[model samples]
Target: MANIQDSAQQLEEAIRNSDEFQNLKQAYETVMADEVAKKMFEDFRNTQIELQEKQMQGQEITEEEIEKARKVVETVQQHDQISKLMEQEQNLNVLINDISKTITKPLEELYGAQEQ
Candidate 1:
């Protein structure tokens, strides 16, 4: 059991020191463009939902209705793009957390062992 724990800690340290993990952590932290994209997507998705609901409720739509729907479609496209970005962010977050735990677990174990 002690050997198993030590091996796991070494493996975690190795990944945290790896170039790929370091690069990903940097990129995820520095990227600000995703914020704008996410906001735009939310706005579009909300509009699409509202317009679709109104159309479904037998609201009398005129020429303005067509324009509104078209706008909603445009927003839907933007939302799709944003959703993709959000998915990427989610994936990166999970990856980062996993890697961080691996990197720090040894230190945590040491502290815990000392306290015991």
Candidate 2:
């Protein structure tokens, strides 16, 4: 277990140092450096969180709330800086998903082989 934990930590460090993560960080920093973009992003994030919380609490998300979120997304998408940041974020997510699949492959193989 200790060895597994150590390996997990190493993997985390590797991911932090990865190009995908670095690019994402750079893009985020670039967006944050612009006051207008930063504020817009913060506002969108806050609204998203509120919507998520409402959903989690079994509250209905009204059409107005949905339209508001859509407008925020549309506005952000129009900004080149935000668009690049979003692209970088998506790339980072893909890398993370690939890593997850790689990490789970051995377990999947073990179970699959036994069933065969």
Candidate 3:
């Protein structure tokens, strides 16, 4: 019937104009969910990059510190060797002075005996 058709058309038009409807709600929710997913993925990617950079920097600093420690060890070893050599030279000088004193003592004793 013509009346039924007209009523149905009016009902369709009213549904299209109404904002408090069920049909658009699903679409809006899907759009908002997509935006949230995009933002989360971006944040995750940025955090991963930042972490990687920090790890790289830490590795470089560790390597530098290791190298510095090696140099310090080498310097200490060199100084230790130098100290040993200096001690050996001082011992040799003391030995030479003892020999000179022993040789001069006999000469002085003979000279005193001749004078007496």
Model 2 lDDT per residue over 52-83, tens place: 99999999999999999999989998999989
lDDT of 1 by residue, 54-101 (tens): 789977667886796677556645554554545555665787788678
Better of 1 and 2 by lDDT: 2
Better of 1 and 3 by lDDT: 1
Candidate 2: stretches off by over 4 Å: 106-116
- Locate the minimum summed-lDDT window of 10 residues in model 2: 1-10
- For candidate 1, report its TM-score: 0.36
Better of 1 and 2 by TM-score: 2
TM-scores, all models, native as reference: 0.36, 0.85, 0.26
Question: 116 in model 2: Cα distance from truth in Å?
Answer: 10
Colliding residue pairs in candidate 2:
none
> Which candidate leads in lDDT?
2
lDDT accuracy of residue 56 in candidate 2: 100
Report lDDT per candidate.
0.65, 0.93, 0.52
Q: How close is candidate 2 to the true structure, as a TM-score?
A: 0.85
